[model samples]
Target: MIPLSRNSAVFGLNIDPIGHHNGAWRHPLTQVSRAYDISYSLELSRMADAAGLDMVFIADGLSVNRYAPDSVVLGFEPLTLLSAVAVNTRNVGLVCTVSSTFTEPYNLARMMSSLDRISHGRAAWNVVTTANPNAALNFGPETLPDHDSRYERAAEFLDVATALWTGWQADAVVADKDRGMYFDPDRVAVTGHHGQFFTVEGPLNAPRSPQGKPVIVQAGASATGRDFAARYADIVYMVSQDLEDAKAYYQDIKRRARDHGRAESDILVIMSVRVLVEQHDNAAQERAAELAELVSAEATLKRVSSFIGVDLTRYALDDVLPPLPEADDIQGYRTQLALVRRLVQSGQVRTLRELATRLNGGQGVLSFTGDGRSVCDNLQLWFEEKAADGFMILPQQTQRDAENFVKFSLPVIRSKPFGRQRPEGATFRSRLFG
Candidate 1:
């Protein structure tokens, strides 16, 4: 049959696995005590699976404790945690972040391949070049690598990793007990990669994964980042404050993908979405207000200062965000800076204090608070504008909000004529993009 054409899709959510917002766990109704519980995370996975979500993702980093006063602390190791969730859920894709800068490609490839085996083709890798300087120090470096170098090394890292993953041919895992051999050595090839960054030898210890090589998910938004995604990513996770900008970004990515000899449909673009739900619209608004109030401006200043590597402590609250003398040189979160600029240009906020409040609560993704219909309306506008292939839903405050989306918004999304459908046990990419 001819390949089907589709305009949009249902994307996954990025659960901090701990929590997304800084003060999310502090909500009176939130299950704060269960934040570290494996069962709690599994329940989330089950909820999304029942709702037919494309996937459930968890972001990770090597270092810890460097969050805004209200920022959530991610305590669980993402890949390991996702493996646990994998056993509990039936269908939803399980995604985990693993930094290319800090990990050896071979080990990462083996672990992800094992996850695919355990999850039955429902695993993905959210490749990241972690930004926190503390993370760099933890990885045996006093100074963080420059942004250009990080991406450069990341590109080669992908090449070596993918080569290793693909080195083992499919059907090599024949458990022929009669022959006293588990597999055929003839099908295994070695990846003799000698590059500027990494030197890896031989085929991966694991067999070829079910989805070929687990889907490549990328979250970089800079020029180099976009190019990297174009070449390697099956899914792109991004943050945008407005639909128009999202549309522009979508168009650019499709263009880039084509220039790189890929079809537009070959890549999925999903935005990080913040959802605030309640029994009614008014209640949802009230919850948002409560969440906003929990953030301390002083805390915001501290977080933003550390985020930008500038201490805003001595500056007057009225002062502009310290001139980013090395703004262009800043690594890791260009998306955050762009949103800050938009808010500044729109006059929605003045002073670094106000900017901090707006940004510190959510991780600078699009924020919305309303009942299901309103939420769907906002989402539809984004999809129609070609601003997104789908969204990574992040519920604010508690699991109640996430539950509300499953009960209310998810059915509506499923009814929409977007996304792809595959056989009952298709791979994660097949379910996400068809």
Candidate 2:
């Protein structure tokens, strides 16, 4: 058992306004800020930081106008937004997603390194593979790469990026004006990388960052993703619907981390959970219903079709699965199909629409409900069971929901000891591991 600390850590939120569920963006209180609205992002970032939370993370995509054009889309690139947030927040870590599949390791290295430096050690990178086929088209590809191939590229991409990050000695920059030297060239080594995915030559033009490299966070729940997280991730963001499954995944990843020669403490497993919080339980439940009602059945079906790579419109609401010999394109569809079968076997859901509702937000990602104390109690249960080291929170509808997390949940969390506190001015690594 991971011993409870003198104080439990406050959870951080990941705002996936559009990516989370169909109705999230349409919530009555949601601000329709342009996806890239820096001021809007900064407000949230500062709020989280002020709450004494660990970080604010943004999930990204290269493609525009996915799922439904009428709905909100990824407005600005995540790294760029992080840079804007860097100017506003003092303490909260800023993590941004970038795909190893589409970006060159060298550019990724430089960008993340610079952001870390600019933020004075508060930047992190969430490495991902671009899984959507539409992303491939947007990036000028005819088809998406196979699942295994994407991981293979990511492995090499990480290797090259790390080499580039380590290429510069921390003492390389010595601004000795009297001696007329800006930096010692001798201490910098060019990272000449030759790989299947990318070729790069570098000493990262940027100097060593505060944390050496931005904390490498990875999020994928697939087998290849698990392997990647075990090997490279400093923080692993996971999506699991149940505590039992969450624990199994957590233990498996930590074990894998040990096999890869990393201490379990070096890896922080963060489950992505959404909470629907209100002043009262009934109010909360009503809010959830309002949010659920905003969901467009057509949009949900389109998203499901996109996710499963089948025309869900053709099937009746209660139709059973057809054979999948023809739907060879969608990587996760196979898993979804299997899950549907199991749900049928278990009698949990009876229709495709019902399955879509269940799977929408809380399906893949863990979700919670009720007042603040209850939510914190549930979180403590997960932490006590070693189901997760912590969580990456996603609020269901409004920014007020996120604000409620900070206002109500955080105080209780910070008051109950669950993990060690870092010394003043501690690095993230120190804060996490010390």
Candidate 3:
């Protein structure tokens, strides 16, 4: 097994204005009007930087559905948004999702490399083979490629992207005004890549950024997904409903990394967790209950149906969740389908109503609700036990809850007893894997 570092745990802030909970926009504390405002995201990113968090992650989807009107349907494009945030924050890493299926490898390489330079080496790319079927119509295809085929394309895309990022050597630039020689052509080379998904001819136009390359991140949980991550991803985002499963996944992925001829410690597994923090335990509980009450059964069914690519509305709310089609059959999020099945098979969830409620609140993410100290304790347990290298904090209510975490939980987490210290690295990659 790969042993975790005893140093401070890595942390990332998921800057979703609507929050991770389905009912977050309905919460009184959330500023629903500013969900699309760049100022709002800048404030959050600045807060994360002040709190000494390692990164700020922005998730994006190419298509929207009418069934989940309250969901985050409209927002700034991720790369563009991250570019803005990059200018506003100094220390925090800027990670954004850009789909391999929808984007060309050459364009992606240039954008990420530019962001890396703009952020002074604080950039990471979350690689995804978009699962949304509606995305196809926008991209001139009737449907998304099959699951395995999508992964195949993503693998080749990464190969080309990485090659472009590294094609120019560090010593390639040697400005000599006396000789009028700005750079050494011999030090740079072309990728000349001709792969199944893409064909790129030469080196990228941009010079290498401070970090050598933007950190590669992946967040898929299928068999092919796992293999792809093991082979290429530097950081991985995972979804787990409980501790046992989290540990199992952590070990499994680390093992896969070893099998791929990479050190287990080379990849960091950060679990996505929703947190609700209040000054007192009772108030936090009340806050969670209030959010739960706002969950609409009809809306939940529609959202869930779209997620698994099945019409769950056909069944009654209280009906036992029927057997699902194979993961290969679903064009949407297959990992979400697997999570639902695991919950049912373990008897942790009984009916469509329960599953809907769970997904609506955390999207099947593990949730911790408590006062600041208690929340810190829960995180410490997970970090020390090796269930997670760190956590991607998804606040239930964005502004207020995020402030509470930074104010109360962060200091406690950074205290000496916890041994959590700011990473000493000058670049984002060094901070993550130094």
Candidate 4:
């Protein structure tokens, strides 16, 4: 079982091909061409593994935004890429995004189950409801479900998938050579799930996984989403701009989890943070500014439009953002939209360009730009305050940034009083909880 260690924060890296910054592919540090090759992903995951990080996450999108095509294209299917990464990196956990909305439960259960076994229990599934409305077109449904319906469907989807995973008992696979028996049939169960969104027949054809069940990861920020996460997720990914908000989210999720009769440790709240590391603070800030300058405003607006189901192109760059639709009127990612909306309405952001810059360049996630030691000190404050169980490093640029984070932050992380010796050859579950 994965044990809890309050001292150490579970670090993770979102190893995107071109980094999380929209302009990463254009930066001097990133080689956009190499990211198209599988080797690039392998290299990043290997670095994460060496750093003793808990997990490496891969985000996936079902459809391409034709309106915002200038940004770097992440071509690899998350599962396919993580599968390759699984065989290559021995210790690090692999987390991949998969929508519960459009995918079949049985198919998803089988694939994730197999991946967990292949990775020897280092697999985590990031459950999503396919927030991008454009994705509906690609899935052969021009119209998308409303926000509440989507979460409802997702709840049922998780139920079916989780049931299928446990359909076969741990001892079901007993290859008795003398009797020519493959397994004990009595130990296998058929899920026989029939629900609002889907019906899944049980006993996954695969054997029970090493971890019994792959870790469950959830990232939903709305009230319904938070409650859903509290009920099922082992990990909750969040986006926050400051410590207070982070702490609030951390406490809220933990409280919601307790309400569901689950321990606070059962849910690991991981904040999505962009870390820009350099030899000096000034240099890091300059690199971040340069990367921001490279992002296309036209593309950024369209990307935002696709996300919030609002056409932002109608407004000029320098003009104050127009009044946004009510949160209920939105069918896309409501939590982030609400965050950004409050920023504009509260006079924190004066222009559309300013908010677009933050969304496109900063990825609507929080940022920490400084030299290695200084950056670690900032993270130390958050960790000690219980703002999060861990921080997922969303690099704004490629190779060098990740290299710097490891080269610089590793020593400090090791030196911290909370540091624990990594258990060798243990399942990712053990690494997290033990």
> What is the lDDT, from 0 to 100, of the residue 327 in candidate 1?
37
Clashing pairs in 2: 5-417, 5-418, 5-419, 6-417, 7-416, 7-417, 7-418, 8-416, 191-202
Where does candidate 3 stray beyond 4 Å? 1-7, 416-419
Residue-level lDDT tens digits of model 3 in 181-220: 8888888888999877788987899878898789999987
Candidate 2, residues 1-434: lDDT per residue as tens digits? 23435344535677554335557777767766634566667777888777667778888766665436755677778898889888887877888899998888889999998888888887788888877776888777888888878889999998999999998899999999999999999999888887787888887888899888888898656666787899999899876655676798899999999999998888889888888787677877887788777765556666656655667777876675444332234464343443344454556666666766776543345567778877778888888888888888887764667777777776666656663333323455544555
In what order do the candidates fall by TM-score, top score first? 3, 4, 1, 2
Q: Candidate 3, overall lDDT?
A: 0.84
Residue 376 in candidate 4 has what lDDT? Answer: 86
Candidate 1 residue-wise lDDT, 339-434, digit = tens: 555676767667877776677576577877788878877888888778888889887754777788777776666555653332345788777665
Off by over 4 Å in 1: 1-5, 66-71, 175-181, 320-322, 325-327, 345-348, 418-425
Kindly list the per-residue Cα lDDT of model 4 for residues 389-423, writing each as its tens digit. Answer: 88898887866788788888667776775444356
Candidate 2 residue 310 C-alpha distance from true site, Å: 3.9
Instruction: Evaluate model 2: give its lDDT.
Output: 0.73
TM-score of each: 0.92, 0.90, 0.95, 0.94
The true-versus-predicted C-alpha distance at residue 167 of model 2, in Å, is 0.8
Q: For candidate 2, what is the TM-score? A: 0.90
